[model samples]
Target: MDAESQRVLEYLTEVEEGAEDVLATKQQIVDLDTKRNQNREALNALKTEMSDSGHPELRGYNLSPLSTEEIKAMNSILKR
Candidate 1:
């Protein structure tokens, strides 16, 4: 093959490498956005829990839940 053909092959290789890099960066951005949205949802849930003073009691047997002290500490953190 001619030198011109070799140069065209090299240029195509370079472009392919760049396209791969762009795809990887785009994937990272998508992952980060998903994480951010999930965190936002969690924060909203926390806010709702904090604002709602009355938590319904759970009945029906031997369910060992958080101690009253632990519950208080969690509530305090939510307050801040």
Candidate 2:
């Protein structure tokens, strides 16, 4: 092939690879966002259940009706 044709082919190849990378990155971001939302819902449900049940631990700690941020912080701390 001519030099110009070869260069064009190479550029097109690079563009295709970059597009694939962007698509994969976007998919990862979407998946993480979905997971985060699910986790938040689960946390909220658990908090409601805990408060409704009047769990002894929460009563002892005076942590009834936990706020989302407080639960998130506690979850992070417990994970560590």
Best by TM-score: 2
Return the top candidate by lDDT. 2
For 38-74, candidate 2 gives per-residue lDDT tens digits of: 9999999999997788856645664469899999999
- The residue pairs found clashing in candidate 2 are none
Q: What TM-scores do the predictions have? A: 0.64, 0.67
Please, what is the whole-model Cα lDDT of each candidate in the order they appear? 0.93, 0.94
Query: Per-residue CA lDDT of candidate 1, range 1-80, in tens?
Result: 99999999999999999999999999999999999999999999999987785544643466789999999999999999
- Candidate 2, 20: how far from true, in Å? 0.2
User: Which runs in model 2 stand beyond 4 Å of their true positions?
Assistant: 55-80
lDDT score for candidate 1 against the true structure: 0.93
CA shift of 4, model 2, Å: 0.3
Find the 10 residues in a row with the least total lDDT in model 1.
53-62
Off by over 4 Å in 1: 54-80
Task: Tell me the TM-score of model 1.
Answer: 0.64
